[model samples]
Target: MRVLVQRVTSARVTVAGEVVGEITPATQGLLALVGVTHDDDPAKAQRLAEKLWQLRILDGEKSASDIGAPILVVSQFTLYGNTTKGRRPTWNAAAPGAVAEPLVDAFADALRALGAHVQTGAFGADMAVALVNDGPVTVQLEL
Candidate 1:
């Protein structure tokens, strides 16, 4: 599993002109673009979720786990795209939807279980994400 974590003031996802999920501006919050791979297991998803919760990237050097900040989790298989070979990105590293969707859901559920206010985009839907990136801080998480 891989997650692209971004610090955001606020974030939202829209699908077919309809808002699907959002996070209100908190003192600190994370926008997670989550991806699942064929080798990823539930344990890995759980571990990554725990890591995100405790990741110390907030202001005052606080962690999201400390401040009870919200998290917006979006399924983003594109994170595994490989474009090194040619113009078109190859998605061989990404798991197929049948295998990936459940892992994505489990990842979000695990984060929520860790006491985060978790918001999520609809799985497998075309989405438009809008965000006010805080500090322009971003990190790639893998497990």
Candidate 2:
């Protein structure tokens, strides 16, 4: 499992020009881009979701769990891209939707269980995401 966490004041996901999910926190929060690989299991996804919820990347270095901050979750299979030996990026490491969608939902479900308000983009849909990045802070984690 891999997650790219970005601190954001607000974030939204749209599908077909219609807003699907959104989170505009009173205090800064996170925009999590999740990717699932073949090796990732439900437990791993849940753990990473917990980690992101408690991660202290907000102003004054507070965790979202501490501040009741909201989170926007989106599926991004491209995080496993491999471009080491070619001009084009290969998606071989990324898990197929059949394996990935459930993990992505598990990640979001875990966050919600942790008491964080979680918003999610439609899986397998063409989405346009918008966000106001707070502090321009972004972190990547692999578990």
Candidate 3:
């Protein structure tokens, strides 16, 4: 499991021109782009969720769990795109939707279970994500 975490003031996801999920926090929030691979499991997803919640990348080095921050979760299979071979990228490293979708849901659920307000983009949909990045802070986590 991997997550690209970005601190944001606000974030939203649109699918087919319809808003699917959004988060506008009073202070700061997170836009989590989650990805899964063949070896990833629910345990790894949960662990990554915990790590994201406690990660101290926000203002004043506060964590999302510390500030009661909201999080926007989006499925991002492309994170595993392999471009090492040639001009063309390969998706072989990314888990197929059948295996990934449930794990993505588990990650979000884990965050929610940790008491963070969470929003999610529709899995397997073509989505447009918009966000105002706070401090331009971004972090990448893998488990």
Candidate 4:
């Protein structure tokens, strides 16, 4: 599993012109783009969630857990895309939806279990994501 995390002042996801999830501008939050690959399981998802909750990339080096920051989780299989061979990217490293969707849900659920408010984008849907990245901070985690 891989997660591309960005510290955002605000973020939202819209599908078909309807907002499905959002983190209001009143607060600083993290936007997590999660991806799944072969050999990934629920345990990995849980561990990643735990790590994200405690990660200190927020203001004054405070973690999300310390400030009770909200998190927006979105499925992003493209994280595993490979382009080492040719001009075109390959999706061979990404897991299929049947295998990835539930794990994405597991990741969000784990964060919620850890007392973090979590919002999620629709899995396997045509969507648009918008965010104002705080400090332009971005981190990639994999397990």
Best-matching candidate per lDDT = 4
lDDT of 1 by residue, 64-143 (tens): 89999889999999999999997999999999999999999999999999899898999999999999999989999997
**Candidate with better TM-score, 1 vs 4:** 4
lDDT of each: 0.92, 0.92, 0.94, 0.98
- Clash pairs, candidate 1, are none
How does each model score on TM-score?
0.97, 0.97, 0.97, 0.99
Q: Compose the digit string of candidate 3's lDDT tens values, residues 27-141.
A: 6899999999999999999999999999999888999999998999999999999999989999999999999999999999999999999999999999999999988998899
Clash count for each candidate, listed in order shown:
0, 0, 0, 0
Tens digit per residue, CA lDDT, model 4, 1-143: 99999999999999999999999999899999999999999999999999999999999999999999999999999999999998999999999999999999999999999999999999999989999999999999987
Worst 10 residues of 4 by lDDT: 19-28
Q: Residue 36 lDDT in model 4?
A: 97
Error of 1 at 52 (Å): 0.2
Error at 28, model 3, angstroms = 0.8
Candidate 2 — number of clashing residue pairs?
0
lDDT at residue 105 of model 4 (Cα atoms): 100
lDDT of 4: 0.98
- The candidate that wins on TM-score is 4
Clashing pairs in 4: none
